[model samples]
Target: MNQDAIEVRGLTKRFGRRTAVEDLSFGVARGSIVGLLGPNGAGKSTTLRAIVGLLRPTAGDCLIDGAPFSALENPATHVGVHMDGFGFETGITARRHLEIIRLAAGAPPGRVDEVLEEVGLADDAGRRVKAFSTGMAQRLGLAAALIGSPRTLILDEPANGLDPDGIRWLRRFLRGFVERGGTVLVSSHQLAELEQVVDEVIVIKRRALFAGRLDDLIRNDVDSLESRYFDLVEGAQA
Candidate 1:
């Protein structure tokens, strides 16, 4: 992995008097899959929003490829994002939705079809989102993220409603994405699934608690991701 594909330097965000995140800092290595782990109310969503320019941090900044997200010439070409609220138009067909996003991203005309197939939704492209299942909606969100053909992906709960088979497919897809020279920073509550694919891990609770490789974090203690995660989250409360 190249040095600091993404860098968050002293990030802080606040809503009026309440602090959401404070002095958080970390780096996502290029061409690597990093899992951002934290329990609910940990400010994970706030941090991701700041990173993608959806919201401004009260202090510090997030840089993608050594430049702040807003500084990127064409952001869609460099960073792809799929967060909690995907805002899919339930009334529209999947293909139409993706085509709209592809146009907005300045992607090629055929890009929508490419992503549809990539996310295993080729046959359902013409189906309206309202008729789809939760798992299918998640897939559509992912397809929207890839429509830009970005080098880096930031996904939140990408496997939210997937079944065992779907989860397995997501794991393989994420690994394959990184192997193809893409970088990923994904947040998921599914520690078991996240553990299977991530090369590095970043755990946070309001601020950065830990950031490093999974192997180093566990150190062969028989305990692994979940154990370390509980330790980290619990420690933060102490």
Candidate 2:
């Protein structure tokens, strides 16, 4: 098992003349939760997509467990990625969605029940996903990510539509997940919310600006990550 759950070396992406990400390099240690902090259009989502092999980097590499992402046959077992705007079929119940993933992954039948309850979706298991509130759908997305018991989880703006209680549950759940030796990489605009759960954060403005311990990054001048984020981006603009 590699100590580094994720590694990106000189990763760069370009869409025509626009550079979404530039010379990005970072490592996420196993059993750690890393917050990818950036303003909108700062390449956070593009970086994530590159990590999961959804979008190939125009330059450099993204590795999972010491191997390139393209080398993995069953990427789902190695990585679970939950991006924004992914919705379930209207007719499928939450429980049934779990069943489908369980069957596809060949995971144990009990795993479905476990994660459903873990994400606070057990009560809504039988309810069709279309009827689920935004928070409930977010919970369901989390449950799906947990189904394969992936070693690494990548989530983008996961708290987008969640309520306070749901956000609290997610914070606790992610903390527990890392405690149990899982690696998590999350991107969110809710810097305050992330401050409550993240162990480390990678702050980027147009490109990689700061990558280090959360405390160290906030030391001296910046009082908090949110404050630091604004400072960094504004500084970049200036």
Candidate 3:
């Protein structure tokens, strides 16, 4: 049996009177890449934030290898996270930014260059973050998340700013990572791109909407993946 790498049980989050997520539960199997899909304000980010311990859940829990993320002895080595709003000081060079994180995370300093190379940012390492393009910034965030060589990755909209070539590279990278026993839970609104990377998907609209293999969501008819996804999410809200 495949072990669960990440598990969210009855996860809920609220901000004042607004309930962001409600009793959301799902799991990403070890060595598999799972997609978190939903429309805007559909609790996708909330769930990811809760999983990474960035936000406190009003109810329920998220676990990595059966333990809360905060409880990990060395969180960096166990899990790497890249969520929305992650930023770097504009004046800092990409190398410096990662060096700071490497120091804090107890990762080897040399790993910074390795990750930059991994993310196709090695040549741009000396450039200030403010000077990088949106796609480059996204690549930097990914490089930071990968610095620790964690077993699991939790990312939100990882392909947000990638160009066609960069997006293609990311797809191959994610697949290679999982083939080596790494697990990933990535969120994205790009259904076609997402479909190319994820083995399974867990969708939500302020609650658990759908959870299963991606093939299950695809119908034999002419309706595209986007069309099918909208239908599912819309049906849940109705």
Model 2: per-residue Cα lDDT over 174-235, one tens digit each: 88988887899999989899887887899876578888788887787639888887877888
What's the true lDDT of residue 47 in model 3?
A: 86
Candidate 1 lDDT, 12-94, residue by residue in tens? 99999989899999999998999999999898999999999899999998999999998998788889999887688889999
Scored against the true structure, residue 177 in model 1 reaches a CA lDDT of: 92
What is the C-alpha lDDT profile of model 3 across 1-238, one tens digit per residue?
7659998999888899999999988889998999988888888888888888889889999999889988998899989988778888999999999999999889987899899999999999999999999899989999999989999988888888889999999999999999988999999888999877889988789887789888787767676668878888989963
Q: How would you order the candidates by lDDT, starting with the best? A: 1, 3, 2
Better of 1 and 3 by TM-score: 1
Between candidates 1 and 3, name the one with more favorable lDDT. 1
- Tell me the TM-score of model 3: 0.96
Q: Which lDDT values do the candidates have, in the order given? A: 0.92, 0.85, 0.89
State each model's C-alpha RMSD to the native: 1.2, 1.8, 1.3
lDDT of 3: 0.89
User: Against the hidden reference, what TM-scores do the models get?
Assistant: 0.97, 0.94, 0.96
Residue 195 of candidate 3: its Cα lDDT?
Answer: 78
User: Which model, 2 or 3, shows the larger TM-score?
Assistant: 3
Candidate 2 Cα outliers beyond 4 Å, as residue runs? 220-222
